[model samples]
Target: EEVTEGEEVERKEHLKTQWARLEAVVGTKARITLIARDLVKHFENRLAALDGKAMVVCMSRRICVELYHEIAKLRPAWAAEADGEGRMKIVMTGSATDPLDWQPHIRNKLRREALAQRFRDPGNPFQIAIVRDMWLTGFDAPSLHTLYVDKPMRGHGLMQAIARVNRVFKD
Candidate 1:
């Protein structure tokens, strides 16, 4: 059956409305807080005994920062003001031009490399890494046992992100 031009337009409009609604729901502060609380609960109750690290893949840089703060609030000991002192860290790349709140997570190449090295170590306190797009591909952390994806990813991107936790690691 052929779709009339009027029907096609109607369908497009309906899709646009749906997309807007989804964006509204997803961009709310309450939803972010809820997700943060649930993530902390999952980590403490489920992923704690795995003796491995976890990565959280967020939809955007802003969400990454917000979620990180929310999680930090729930688990104060998991957060630190300095990069060298955090159990949970945001590992996204950003610039000085970005918001001042993001400056701590925005590191130079050497700092990023240091963070990467720490993340690769199974015994390091740096366990949870909140990221937008940096370590999704061409990065390997065998000790990474859990991946919490809050972003919409598909095709090769999705596969690579999931593969972050698929590495072989000894108990």
Candidate 2:
């Protein structure tokens, strides 16, 4: 699907609006932003605060490149933080390939310290790109409270997705 430049912009705008609505219902301190090209900045500024804090970066295979690039930039800084004691930590889940398995341009591969994941069911799932990813369901991160969603999603998936940020933390 060759979505024209115009179409992609429209989709981003639409997602931004929806996110504003989801923000109200999501718990305090929890937020979702629709950052098109600035995904890296958002991650460094918002998600980075959780670095070395025991968290999961759940996202679709499609955007993993952007995620990877961003994390690569921040690795040095986090390496100093001392995760869970004396280690730097970051857990990512996605298929062995790319996040957007549909896009041939986005090639996924094992890079640096990041690990890959393959959800049991493949194409059988109703693919609503805006929402498909491994970090969405049944995943827990006690230190996770804010989620930055750069993609789209709806219905049960939407609810379960952000809910990943709801786990309680101690001290």
lDDT of each: 0.84, 0.38
TM-score of every model versus the real structure: 0.84, 0.39
Residues 1-171, candidate 1: write the lDDT tens digits. Answer: 011223677787775676557656675799999999999989877565678889998867788888989988899999997777888988877888999988877888888889999999988999899998889899999989889998667777899998998877894
Error of 2 at 144 (Å): 1.8
Identify the leading candidate in terms of TM-score.
1
Q: Candidate 2, which segments miss by more than 4 Å at Cα?
A: 1-60, 74-132
- Those runs of model 1 whose alpha carbons end farther than 4 Å from true positions after fitting are 1-24
Candidate 2 per-residue lDDT over residues 61-160, each given as its tens digit: 3334333334435443432222122122233334445345333322234521122121111211111112225546775444455565544555776788
After the best TM-score superposition of candidate 1, give how far the Cα of residue 16 lies from its true spot, in angstroms: 13
